[model samples]
Target: MKKDFLLSSNDQLEKFAGIVNGDHPLKKVTPEEKIKVGVDLGTSSIVLTVLDSKNQIVYGAYEYDHAVQDGIVVNFMESVNILRRLKAKAEKVLGRELTTACGAIPPKTGEKSAKVVANVIEETGMMCTGIEDEPTAAAKFLRLSNGTVVDIGGGTTGISIFQNNKLIHVIDEATGGFHMTLVLGGRYKIKNDEAEKLKRNKEKEQEVYSVIKPVVEKMAAIVQNMGAEINDPVIVVGGATNFTEFTTTFSKVLKRKVYKPLYPQFVTPLGIAMFDE
Candidate 1:
């Protein structure tokens, strides 16, 4: 049997049009016509999204937990168990067995680590169709005309530079949501678990932002360090970058326009599903 592969595009505008207008034609088709799924095994959460033959979002589900730390499958069985539970939930919502999906990892991850992610997905009774870097996946979803993709997930900051919709460079470094949580935890003298919850509270945005400013600044330095390589606006994604003023803050720091898509957190998973097998 032939294997399916994820979609890789160099044209940001084309990618964006397909996602927003749903003109990819795959989305218009039925579930039977749609045989592919996308599973995002993020450090902070694992998300699964399904697109029918016409490429429409038929079902999507996600679970938040530290099963995978720093994009590595720390507890193999625990991660697999989480994937299994999410798979069942997604199957229930789609009303069918979802056996094939694409998964992703960061650009800097080793081949072995990427395979581990693929293996975890397969353990859920689903075929791992394709695997790509997180920022690459986000780029496919955004289809930016020109700029950089900054994916600030729980454990790492992934950066992908693109021009004319084609990826020209890629970089991934450790330092993301986890660092923020650690900072907040230290400042309040609370547990890391409680700090995570407090960080998500809207009322605590100001307080949390103040505490994590240094972390964000470090992220800014990462961007600044890579600025010479990219020329377009910067697009930010991932759960860590979901704070209320994140984009604005990043914009101010970088002195460039930063755009966050609708449901920014789901961007990579959706892009993973769009991979054309």
Candidate 2:
């Protein structure tokens, strides 16, 4: 992908981050305008994204959560409740109800995983428009037709290869941000929750990255082991890629350049919204 193309996507993600941070006000949705919605049920958080008919972001919200583990919903009702609250929050901000939403799961999790995700979306009182794999959605949001998309969520690092805009191969591994938290907790002799907070602290990021670098290397090794003809513009997205050194560490291990977008966490959610039809 061209650098300017990725820059444009990052610009959109930057705007979405501002809206999520309350730095940018939410855009209003007229009554007749069709609003597309997306719900991302991640291991550490559940994100709700609203997009205009033309795929422009309008609103986005998320809540830290543990209702999901890996790509599966471990606590169905909790997932429903979080999504419902997010839907209510978006509706209040946009002054219109979200009628339909698309959701996503880690690749190859099977039809059951998709059903659970869609169920959660419907439980929020919005029609479930569709269920897509996470990397596919991330690729869509990045406008990537060809390249590799590695979606690192809280509980898993999913590697996907796309050719001609179609997903040709995908695999999800059981290692991600939560593993980093566990490593930090073990090293600092703190509980997982405290370690999670410490891992996200910008001031402590250097130390945290040092402790977690091995785990990231393992994730990259998974990609390398896949033995696929890894394509250029290898993009990494999702919440687990938040560390500034993440891509560099990953690239070192994989022996290839890696790309990442601003607010890496919101990529899948924003892309899921584009699937709402």
Candidate 3:
């Protein structure tokens, strides 16, 4: 799927982008009196984020856990427990109650997991006010009126095609971080846990990318199979694409501008906070 392509030659990626790695930038800023939080029970990790009235980051936290796979919760109690911890931390940091929150599900995985996602957030001591598709939630911050938002999760790569800020098509396929971990596990004959850790280590990234290149290719192919012209810049988020070179490979495959934010992993969870109601 590797092919050369030039840059977008447009301001799409930069003009409509959201916060890039708010961990430091959002700190020390005055938070709104009222705050809204979002919980993303991702397949590889559970993330809790807080946004103020103006939709700025007030607090954010996440923990790694394979409680979910391809967006379906496998260990409901474990997920609940993680969210509980995250909520406590956010509340402590923000010095306020976080009683209600919003959450999201991967594309096509919603029918079976949307209620579960909302329930997980609720069980963690907060009222689940809304449950939205992952890509839709991300769109709240991306504000890209036209383009594709590709959510590369732990176990699935979700594609959402939008035209004029409204969703026109969506797809979720089994391919993502988990696949990369699997490849690393097999290559090193190590446990899945060890592979996951190694995959995230800066020292091992170069070696790991060589092994996970195929998995990245699968993600690019997933986007390609969507059967659209897909010429606009593709905005990628999620932990899987956090690997430095995933977009380089994806851009070559699609022969189009593929943009990944500085903190791709936080994009969706933070965006989820925008829908708080």
Candidate 4:
């Protein structure tokens, strides 16, 4: 019950929320300032986040794409293209070239995945200074201490238990947004792209959630199977957790407190950026 991680204050998180517009979520940073960058190549989306020298968020961009699927660079050129576009967008907004960045991959992903991540960052014209497991980067971003950080990414759900600021256990499971898309696609007999649209559309969000519930439950089960003694509140991050209904489903399944920050999708990316300096 005692808090330890360096959390963004409630007010700071409120500023981060802004709102989600899958078409384009871009925030302009104050111009002419040194900044740290974090590039997150997630299974469903690629995010570019920038923080000023003070570690305050400045500019960020998010794009929904399948360049990387399930922690692997399924499409290398697609991954590079997404990162380049996102980087260009952020740089234009901040009016300064982004030169260095940190990135993250799923827990226990092999060396090849790591190289792909680093290479994509380089292809985008930024030096990939550091690469860490997604959960550990989340922990660093959160200054996490004694709790579980569950990153429910697009193709995988990663869980890392941190006790006293040190990671105790980390696991990755292959059940995430893609599975939900499968359910939606099959139920409506639509293509994967259409299902992705339906899944991200706010208008149909509630209606489609019922169909996606099982996928969420499966993710919760994956966490439970980790077998770690998790008594602290679980902090959920990643784009898949962006679903407004997911936290409730996770809480009920885990029978423990669940928390999501203002912009769950940006957490890991922002955390990865924070680790840059």
Best-performing candidate as measured by TM-score: 2
Comparing 2 with 3 on TM-score, the higher-scoring candidate is 2
lDDT string for model 4 (93-151, tens) is 66788899998899988788898889989987889898889988887767678889998
Error of 4 at 62 (Å): 1.5
Ranking by TM-score: 2, 4, 3, 1
TM-score of each: 0.87, 0.97, 0.88, 0.89
User: Between 3 and 4, whose lDDT is larger?
Assistant: 4
Predicted model with the maximum lDDT: 2
Off by over 4 Å in 4: 1-10, 19-33
Score each candidate by Cα lDDT: 0.77, 0.90, 0.79, 0.80
lDDT string, candidate 1, 1-277, tens digits: 1111112332332443454344543233344575568888887788877766655555566778787888777887878998898788766655678878788987788899889988998888888887888888887765565778898888889999988878889888988898899999999999989999998898878878988988887887789887579665677888888677787778778887677665577778777888847
Error of 2 at 239 (Å): 0.9
Better lDDT candidate (2, 3)? 2
For 119-207, candidate 3 gives per-residue lDDT tens digits of 88888778988888898777677666777889988988888888887788888898889989999999999999999999999888899
